[model samples]
Target: MPARFMQMQEVADELSVSVSQVYHMVRSGELPAIKVGGRGQWRIERARLEDYIERKYTETADWVRENPLIGREDEIDPSD
Candidate 1:
């Protein structure tokens, strides 16, 4: 079974972003994470990560709706 919680580095790898970027997200409250251990390491729950991804998709959809690109839908296929 996969881990229920992931380390900061693991979250970064999963998102294909830098570890520092992940830290920024956590610090900024864009991504949910909690510090564990006496060493103060950050851990993210898998469910929260999934929620963040879903929220991003929703945000992108809203942006696309609000800011439609001109001629995007009518663009001809260059391959044709």
Candidate 2:
């Protein structure tokens, strides 16, 4: 197989999350990772990370649509 793997720290930094969060992701199987050689080390696929990011974006967009920004009609007035 190819070296399509990223360290937990790198992934954590990229996601702006704590290492424990990344560990939780690996533990919960949210991120595609593998523990190899009887070690607790975790490695995630870059593509899987990208997919997770895309999913988050989609979810955030849906949430924004459901809960529109807080503003008023006067915020867009013509006769100001």
Top candidate on TM-score is 1
Q: Kindly report which residue pairs in candidate 1 clash with one another.
A: none
Best by lDDT: 1
Go through the candidates in order and give the C-alpha RMSD of each one to the true structure.
4.1, 6.9
- True-vs-predicted CA distance for residue 73, candidate 2, Å: 12
Which parts of model 2 have CA positions greater than 4 angstroms off? 1-3, 72-80
State each model's CA lDDT, in order: 0.94, 0.85
lDDT of 1 by residue, 4-78 (tens): 999999999999999999999999999999999999989999999999999999999999899987878677577
- Residue-level lDDT of model 2, residues 1-80, one tens digit each, is 64578899999999989999999988888777887666677789888899989988999899979987477555756863
Q: Report how far off residue 73 is in candidate 1 (Å).
A: 8.4
In model 1, which range of ten residues has the least summed lDDT? 71-80
